[model samples]
Target: MSFDKFKPKYKIHSETENYFKLRAEAGAKPYDQLTVEEAREGNIANAKRFAGTTEFEGTVKEFTVPSKQCSDGIPITVYRSKQCDLCVAPSVFVYFHGGGNVVGCRQTVDTICRIFSRDAPCVVVNVEYRLAPEHKWPANHEDAICVVRWVKMNKGLLGAVNRSTVGVGGDGEGSRMAALVCHEVPDLGYQVTCIFHASAA
Candidate 1:
């Protein structure tokens, strides 16, 4: 049976209803029916499409930088608001995209990073970590730690508002990584001022 028949009875906001309509039209396959690679590609495509519709008042810069914790260099996209040009150092928010540890990349959260950068008036670093089932548990977590550490160590280079005002955050599986980073890296000199998690509803 088609899942649309099970739509919620309660009235949802128009925007939400439109979002569901878009998803339904996208014809996403059941996760169980797809291979890891297929799921990843599909999620990326969806994210890119969603991102294309968003308009944020910020500048984005892409980089492929080395990570001490992971052999494969990390890919990061930095988002900064125009106001940031006036400030000597903008605060930083390191973001991880949601994918249940199996699907997603930096592009998956491109729009989110832009929103955060504009609204928070801080630099948003969207991290692209290796996925799971292929690169198992703790791998993503380790990558989170590495990215946070790398940001902390290189805050000046990142144009951070202040080296001391760093934060970690994510959605879904990415949230788990953010929480882990906050919990595991307490000893780091710079404090993670915020830990934002957009858990699934």
Candidate 2:
């Protein structure tokens, strides 16, 4: 029986295909089967192996936002591109990285945040929210809300004091948190999501 008749409607990206092939060759276990530590390590390894380097021209700094959920606080990295005007402050974005709220960290999306700051030309506030199998539900969500609220209130931290000066966003699961935040927080200037299908309503 010829199976050519059964064709896939969506084409797989070459890089994605290569990833699966490589994983299979290495006998990698499915994500669900792996221990939390293994999954987190794999995420870091994949990011380093596949994510291309960017020529970022910017100033980078780190700070912590006082979380409403806990005393530990949320850590954040601030990226300000060289192109940003010294006199006129740019809008700031509270960024989150995707890892199903289970894995991934600030470094996982560090370079991507640089690209956003350089290309999108905004101050990128990369967030480090709590992970699961540890902090549990409402912890990560509350952390995101706390950070955005903190940014909204402490606009001077990023020098984004002007109108429409604060926004929130992320990729994948992180993007999901951003969308949820938009629903809860009022007057969020903008939302930048990468490869996330948020509801139009």
Give the candidate number with the greatest lDDT.
2
For model 1 the TM-score comes to 0.80
**Candidate 1, position 85, lDDT:** 70
| Deviation from native of the Cα of residue 3 in model 1, angstroms | 7.9
Instruction: Tell me the lDDT of candidate 1.
Output: 0.72
lDDT of each: 0.72, 0.79
User: What are the candidates' C-alpha RMSDs?
Assistant: 4.2, 4.8
156: Cα error in model 1, Å: 0.8
Model 2: per-residue Cα lDDT over 62-173, one tens digit each: 8898865788779989998886765376888899998888878888898888988888788889999999989888888898998998888877767566563788888988
What's the distance in Å from true for residue 82, model 2? 0.8
Candidate 1, residues 45-75: lDDT per residue as tens digits?
Answer: 7777666745676567877667665676888
Stretches of model 1 off by over 4 angstroms after superposition: 1-11, 54-59, 86-89, 161-164, 187-201
- Per-residue lDDT for 31 in model 1? 71
Candidate closest to the true structure, highest TM-score: 2
